[model samples]
Target: MIDLKSAPELKALEPKLNQFFDLAKTKITAIDAEYDNSKGSPVFTVEGKYTTRGWTEWTEGFRYGISVLHFDATGDESSLKSGRDQTVSKMATHVSHIGVHDHGFNNLSTYGNLRRLMLEGRIPDNEWEKNFYELAIKVSGAVQAARWTERQGGGFIHSFNGPHSLFVDTIRSCRILMVAHRLGHVLMGEGDKPINLLERALQHIESTAKYSVFYGEGRDSYDERGRTTHEAIFNTKDGAYRCPNSQQGYTGFSTWTRGQAWAIVGFAEELELLKEFSDEELAPFGGRSEIEAMMLKAATATADHCIENTPVCGIPYWDTGAPKLHLLGDYMDRPADPYNAYEPVDSSAAAISAQGMLRLGHYLMAKGDSAVAEKYIDAGLKMSDSLFAEPYLSTDPKHHGLILHSIYHEPNGWDHKPESGKAAYGESSMWGDYHAMELAVYLQRLIKKAPYYTFFA
Candidate 1:
């Protein structure tokens, strides 16, 4: 069993963290050579096997941001320049487009990185930086407002249009929105817009809470009102809408481990954002105490579930309730091609959740709830330590991906499969790695800040 109560010493992790960052930088540099900017977006893969080659909208920006964060942590000037240039190039092309639904994902990393650049004094007062920052904030606000759904208690929906489309992934997307709001406040000397955005965000969170509760109950995929109709669908393609002609529900009701991790991290992030608001401002939505309590509940519940279900290595299966491994062949719509059907633990999800738990623990500690906080942080630290020890992380030269054994499809009987040989990594997703890097950076920051805050108080 993964020990939640015991934490590996952080000092031991320094070398591993450095190695991971270096590996990430090397991989990112190699990948950049394949980017075809003339084609308008980054290509999906470098191996040239898959014909679908346009830049995937979100991942490109995410990669740039991750690169920036890695450089910031390591002070690698060349890596920093590469990340900055990539972000600047992408922001120039994509930031103004209103049609894209993933502005939060696309812009947050791009502009958020730029904001960090400005804060770090790496970039001078330049017009390009200024323009990108403004554009990011504007586009993010638009997307958040556009995706707002009344049925889900007022939270942002997953994408622009489509039935059966409420997703837990919005947790990450919403964090971008929060980041935009915070940036606007800090950079533009603005407050009202941030306040309004926070209110909208809180409403959305309440809606998510309500819909998520229903989803937990396992009703129909969506109600007539268009909220999540079921309670048991942990990971869904959409929030509450069901695919029209299929009883199987294209909603993707399987409990995606990363999506769950996103929720745990996202909720903790939202609580932090909300705390920035004054007590009076937060009063109407729910008092600060209530918000804190709700966050604590979510943190504890998800952390417990993650610990209980995570594998011995601290990685989690793609779906918590996935059917037995042997029975996978029986349910395959396609032949059990070893190419597609291999079960693997999602290392990225484990990393992200571990980081989220660490943050949640810090939040709890601030609220004078150290026991639960310690539990959460220790769990995260243990998971990170296990990930550090895995030989598979460095052994497979072809496996450019960070974590192994992630399941892209469990119902189709593809779990714990090697993503190395696959054409596109079988959705051995980019966002997972993005979150993993983010978790590492955040954990490092928290470790530094926590002692000072606790000591001074």
Candidate 2:
């Protein structure tokens, strides 16, 4: 389990956070310089260099969004220009992308970050530029919302797999719908019926909470609280949930750590988004108290599971129940060994989950729960400390990836394994790199006493 008792505070981690930003400037610039956009979005590192994979075209935003986030942290105009130019020149398809459940991951990271900067007055408030971004986000959110698969009482934004699949990753993508609703946008359905974006988002959120997350109440033999399935299959005809499944983890019964990380950050961000709405706005769904309680229950359960399951340093293996994990006997008693011959650690999951812990911690504090809040915040800081240093953070200028030891599609044999190691290691993914930057920027803002960072902000 993650050793939260000795975890450092946010103030203590300031120097490392600053160091990470400094290193990020070079890493972001290097990727921008070397990556050939024509090949496709750089998916993950192969032997320390970035490469592409033809998987749903979901990562281009993270590639460009890294630059935008770099500019946000260090005020680098060059990075800003690269991000803005790419968003204009390259991201239109993602805005109208009707095939995938990643609009928030693609659009929010780029256009959303840019719009947040404009709202903060960090950039010149050009009215047209702001509208351009707003329009893009509005379209992106509606397009994402339009990919709905109706269930009994609600529905989900189905994965590219088809109408019957509900991916846990889309929980975070639901942010696009929330943002579009905030901007006074809605999806126009058949016969010019205006569909409420917020309702769609809420339904998707509740569906994920109900179907994707296991609460350990014996839904299945393998069910465990806070254990998240990568995918939930449903019968489209009657909208009946079929079974828990996995695309990247070892099996349907196992918890893919990255999917678990998605749930962590996804629900935490939803809680933060909820703060912006009035009780009246939330009444139609379940009212603010009920909604908050449901989200809080899911958030805390997953976080507690993470703390209990991860190694001492707060990093986890790609999947908790990876078959070979038993080979690394007593693994949880020590720090995660990324170089272990048995199973590789996934720093990318750590990067994403750390932010979730931090945000959930802050949310709890605001609600007058200081003791439990500190545990999550400290666990987040502890994970950040592990990720910003050697073996995880790539210091080699020749390596295009910013963070190392990220795994993608382990079940498909898609990740590159080192020539010498039996397991996959020394790789970084686009989502992994982007979330690490997001985590750094979050802490950087806190350290500098800057405006509190949120996607909506």
Worst lDDT run of 10 residues, candidate 2, spans 415-424
Deviating ranges (above 4 Å) for candidate 1: 35-56, 92-101, 120-131, 152-155, 160-164, 183-195, 213-254, 326-342, 391-399, 407-428, 446-457
Q: Can you give the lDDT of residue 52 in candidate 1? A: 27
Candidate 2 C-alpha lDDT tens digits along 120-169? 99999999999999999999999999999999888999999999999999
At residue 276, candidate 2 shows an lDDT of 95
Query: Tens digit of lDDT per residue, candidate 1, span 74-185?
Result: 7777777887887766565456544444556667666766665665565566877676676666666555545544442244454433323455555556655555455453
Error of model 1, residue 360, in angstroms: 0.4
Q: Distance from true position, residue 125, model 1, in Å?
A: 6.0
lDDT of model 2, residue 167: 93
TM-score versus the correct structure, for each prediction: 0.76, 0.99
| Total backbone collisions, model 2 | 0
Q: Which ten residues in a row have the lowest lDDT in candidate 1?
A: 224-233
**Which candidate's lDDT is highest?**
2
